[model samples]
Every structure is written in C-alpha cells, then in structure tokens.
Target: MNRTLTNTVKPDVISDFKEITKMRLAVSVVFSSVAGYFLGAEVVNFVVVLLLAIGGYLMVGASNAFNQVIERNLDAKMNRTKNRPIPAGRMSVTTATIIASLFTILGIVVLYIINPVTAMFGGISIFLYTCIYTPLKRVTPLSVFIGAFPGAIPFMLGWVAATNDFSIEPGTLFMIQFFWQFPHFWALGWWLYDDYKRGGFFMLPTGKRDKGTAIQIILYTIWTVVISLIPVFGVTGRLYLTPISGVLILILGIGMLYYAFKLYKNKDEKTAKQLMFASVSYITLLQIIYVLDKFIRIWI
Candidate 1:
C-alpha cells in the first residue's frame, strides 16, 4: 500500500485544473448559463441554478480538455494553440484523460439532480463537443454548425434547468446564439486564417479573405439581430417582443450589425478584429439586456 501510494499520481492540481478547464472558456460559458437562467426563469430557484452553473462548466470544460488532448499535435502547429498546456508539455495525456472523464460524469450527475432534461442536454453537449466537434474540425468547415449546436446549448440549458421544461423561450435563446455564431466565428476565422491554415483547418467559408465571406458575415449578423427581436411581437406564437424591449434589442443588434457591416465593407484585418471584439461584447450585452427587460416588466 505504501509503495502504491508513493507511485500514485500527484500533479499540480491548481494548474492542471486551469489547463483542463480552459479556464477562460469555462468562465464565459458559465456567464451565459446564468444569464439564460435569469432571462427565462420566472421564479428564482437558487439550488437548481447553481447546479446548472457548475454542471455546465464541468461539461464544457471536459469538452475542451478532450479537444486539447486530441488536437495536441495539430494545435502545436498553430500559433494560437501552440502554447496550450497539453502541447506545451505541462500536462500529460493521461492526466488530461482522467480529468475529462471525471468532469463529464460529475457534470451529468449534477444536472440529473436538477432535472432529467438538464442531464440529457448536458450529456449530449459533452458527447457532441468531443465525439463530433473535435474530429469535424479536421474534416470540414461545416463543423462550425455542428459545434454551434453544443455551444448554443448553454443559453437554452439554463432555461430548461429553471423551468424543468423545454419551451419556445429557450428556443429563442438558442436561435440568437445560433445566428450570432456565423459572424462571431467568421471574424475569428478572418483574424486567424493563417494560423488555422498552418494547422490545415479551413475555417472561413471563402477559404480566403474575400468579398463573398464578408458578405456572408454581414448577412448572418443581420440574422442574429432579427431573431434577437422575436420576443417583441404579439403574433410570434408564445414569444412576444414588447415594444420597449424590442427597441432596446434592436439598438443592441444594430450596434453589432454596424460593426459587421464595417468589417464587410473594409475587409481589413483591423476591421475584422474590431468586429470580433464587438461581437463578443454584443452577445454579452444582449444577454444582460434580456434579463433586465424581464425584470423591468415585473417591476414596472
């Protein structure tokens, strides 16, 4: 027992946690889950919300850890990912594998305690992100859509976790994130096209910085704004966009669309980067606006 204990694994648990979590990505996903919960939850259920947050983080983090493990070699070829913990040799493949499995199991169990639907989505998200997305990246640009399905789930998962049911409200959340991905992701594609190319990944549609891709970005940006305002209409089938909230969302969406338009018109690296920054802020702000609008209605 002592000899086995001596040989038992010891790691810099702190750094390993950070590395396995893709700390920044997990943080962003958690914020989205919280916002989605607030936006859709009519009654605040602190316990379920907390579970969803932690479960969402663990599941998403596991996805990222497995991705890094699979792509360590390809990541080493790309400037952006060359310094990742896996490729940079700070963490071993064995350690990463164990962490990924534990997170998935723990995350699903937590979500299951909240509600079966939450568990289902969380499980599928981890599966899609790892089994589907990780490999698709090396195969096709269509992987973006496949990956977006999992990426877009956080928005809806929060709503379902809160209501213990799936409904159009969560669907609205899903659509917003779904449409937002095109411009947001394509903008990153523009900025990192070269780095991605070095890794043999064609992320951009045009496969080159050209008018076609720019036009596509503009179109998707517009679509993102359009769907975001669906809550304002009385005739949208259970989803009504109140006039005031509609206007606020419109302004926010237009703010984002304007940047997308600028990037399309300019087709320069700086413009593309600016659009990417705007898109990040745009989604975050949109979620804030949604939650605020929901609260404002009750208060007013």
Candidate 2:
C-alpha cells in the first residue's frame, strides 16, 4: 500500500511542479524569444538560439512560480486559479521557492554565457514580473502596464542575444509587443473580471468592464498595429519588412481589431473571450510573419 501510494504521489508532485511553472505560458514566451532571435540574426547560431530558448523558458517559469508563491492565497479565491498547485495545496511554498531560485540562477548563468546584456535583461524580466508586477496586481490597475515591460523583454532580449546591442531594431520589437499586451490582457481581464475581482486583482485600466476598458483596448490595439509596421519603414536600420509582409501584418492587425470592436459593441463575456483568443492568434502569427519576412527579403 505504501509503495503504490508513493509511486502515484510522485507523479502527481511532478505534474503540480509543472503547473506552478505555467509551462505552456513559459513555452510561448520562449517562442517569442526565438522569433526575435531569427529576426535579428544575420547568421543563425543554432547553439545560441537553443540557449536563448532554454534560458527564456527558465526565467519565465521562475517568474510564474514566484507569482504563485506570492499569490497563493489570492489565487485560492479565484475559480480559474484555485486549482493551481499552490492554491490547491498540491505544492508547498518551500518547494516552489527552491524551484524558482534554481531556475533563476541557471537561467541567468546560461544567458550570461551568451552576453552580459542578455543575462541582465533576463534578470530584469524576472525581477519586474515577480517583484513589481505581482504585488502591484493587488494594489492598482497599472500592474498590467508594469507587467508589459517584462512581458516585452523576451522579444528584445532575443535581439540582444543575437547582436549584443540595444538599438532601434530591438526597441521597435519591444514597443510592438509592449502595446500588444494591453489589448490582449485587457480582453482577458474583461472576460475574467469577476474572477480577478474575487482574487483581489485590479488588472483592467478602468477598474471595471465598461466602455472605458473597451475603449482602452481598442486604442492599444491601434497602437500595437501601428508600431508593428514601423520597422517596414527602414528607419529602424537593421529590421525592415517587405511590402508583402507589411500588408500581411496590416491584415492580421485588422483581424485583431475586428474582435476588439466586437467586444466593445457586445460588451459581453462571449465577445471578450473571442477577443482574447484573437489576441493570442494575432501575436503568434505576427511573430512568425516577422521571422519569415526576414528570410524572404534575403532570398528576394
């Protein structure tokens, strides 16, 4: 009986550990980093790209674990988060802390091997996400704004990893992602307002799912679309898209805006959910487009 229980419990523990790290979200962040690497790299270094992906995932996972540790009690109050490892009592704070520490240390060391700038940005991303944004979620609506900085870091960090420079190109990538998160997160906040309120988190700019919130989402969506196209102007120096890719990005941006408009008009949970999914699809496809356009321009 004891041996059977141990075997069962061990697998459960491992699953819970993965949950605490928010593995899916971490992996997505790594994908963005990889896209940035591809966009910036003239000669792709497969080994460095691998390291960036690994390091990016570790830092993102560590940030999520730290967030869970700090918000365990708050998380327990939200239906969506109550089943998470920490809130569900499936994982202890001490264990999570150890995991976070190890990930942070290893992630920084791995990035530093590529360049100190890459490691510095990685550390800053973790710090901003865990130390600042996590607690600010309960204090003010600006937490989402603060969180966007760290959220945008992976995209720029990839460029820094490739070139070890913080120039106009990476800055443009950072801005594009920075504005994109507002609409994306606000749509999610709108749909999950009740759960977030129950969790004592103030994520929406307007503090409620009203016209004010919807308006902000639309505005940011516009800004995101505008900034994403700026690179095509060639003013960014190292990163410029061709006419075809620029049009593709414009169409994708409009697709996201269409959902944002629908959410505004309907002001319902269903519309908000659609907008949330659209936001995800928009960013992912936009990143892929940027990478593909980068190589296509060379071939053409």
Candidate 3:
C-alpha cells in the first residue's frame, strides 16, 4: 500500500514540475540558442554546446517558473492558465516560490560556468521577463515590446557563448529574432484576447483585433524578412548567407507573409491562430536554414 501510494504521487509531482517549468517552451528556447551556437562556432565544441543547452533550458525554465509565481492570482482568472499548477491549487505559492528561487540560482551558476558574458545575458533575460515584463503586462501593452528583449536574447546569447564576443554577427542574429516577435506574439494575443483580458493582461498593441493591429503585424513581418536578408549582402561580418540560401529564406518569409495577410483580411480567431502557427514555423525553419547554409558553405 505504501509503495503504491508513493508511485502514484511521484507522477503527479513530476507533472506539476514540468507544468511549472513549461518544459516544451524551455526546450524550444534551448534549440534556438544551440542553433545560434552552431552559426557562430568555427569548430564545433560538443561540450560547450551541451553546456549551452543545459544552461539555456535552466534559465528559460527559471524565468517561466518565476513568471507563474508572480502571475498566479491573475493566471487563476484565465481559462487557458487556470489549470496551471499554481493557479489550480495543486501547488502552494510558497512551494512555487522555493522552486523558482532554486531554479534561478542553479541556472545562473550553470551559465556563469560558461563565461561571465553569457551568464550576464542569461541573468538579464530573467530580470527583464520577471521584473519588468511581468508587472508591465497588467499596466500597458508596451510590455510585449519589453518582453521581446529577453525573447530575442537566447539566439544571440548562444553566439556570445561560442565566440565570447559581441559584434555584428551576434547583433544580426539578435535583430532577426527581435523583429520577428511582434507578428508572432500579436497573433497569439489576438487569438486569446478574451482570455488575456480576463487575466488583466494587455498584449496587443492596439488592445484589440483591429485593422491597426493587423497592419502592424504585416509591417513587422516585412521587417523580419528584410533583416534576415542583410547577411546575404556580405556586410554582417562573419554571418554571410549565400544567394541560394537567401532565396530559400525569402520563399519561407513569403509563406509566412501570406498568413499574416490572411489574418489582416479575415480578422477572425481561426485566421489569427494560423498566423501564430506560421510565425512559429517561420522562425524555427529560418534558424535551421541559416545554420545549414553555413555548414554547407564550409563543406564546399
């Protein structure tokens, strides 16, 4: 009876931990950082990549955990977030706080082992997300703009980790992800506008699914495509893209742009969700293409 009780409770505990950390989102963030490491590395270092993956995941997880802790009461009001561990009453505030604190300390220590610069950026990401972005969400829509800073950091953070330098190469990487966030997140905000309003979060720029918001999404999508092509001009230091890869990336951008325009025309939840999915695919595939193009050029 005792053994069975322990076994039954263990899975619930693990599930709660995964929910608190937002394991899938953390893994996706780690993937972006690893891809950036590959793009910046001259000779691949498996150990450093492993360390980056671990440290990046921990830092992202810690940020998410702290976010949940800060927004626990607000989260309880939203249908989407109401089931989360903290909001659902499965986990106490004190327990979640302790877990978040442990994650923050462990994550920083792990990142610091890589180098001071990498660790510093990791710390900044957490601080911006928890300290600045979290509270600002309730007050204004500018929170999304501020949140993009931390969201954009992981990609370039990997470059800094591999090269230990801040230059045009990492700056280019940063800008690519930075401009991409607006359309990506705004689509999500549009789809969940009601739920977010319940949580007292202001996510959209215009605070509604209006023509103004759709136009801005289209504008940012255009900016994302343009920034992605800059490396092909041979001006971004070591981050040059071949013509072939540039064309392929252009095609992918056009595909995402199609969805962005669709949302603008339809102005409905389903269309907004489609744009959200397209934006996610666009960013992920863009990173993969960039890394693969670099490796292919080196091989030739």
Q: What Cα-based lDDT does every candidate model obtain?
A: 0.84, 0.92, 0.93
What pairs collide in candidate 2?
none
- Off by more than 4 A, model 2: 1-7
Those runs of model 3 whose alpha carbons end farther than 4 Å from true positions after fitting are none
For each candidate in turn, the TM-score is 0.92, 0.97, 0.98
Top-scoring candidate (lDDT) = 3
The TM-score measured for candidate 2 stands at 0.97
lDDT of 1 by residue, 75-128 (tens): 999988887788888888998899899999999999999889989999999999
Give me the overall lDDT of model 1: 0.84
lDDT winner between candidates 1 and 3: 3
Instruction: Give the C-alpha miss distance for residue 91 in model 2, angstroms.
Output: 1.1
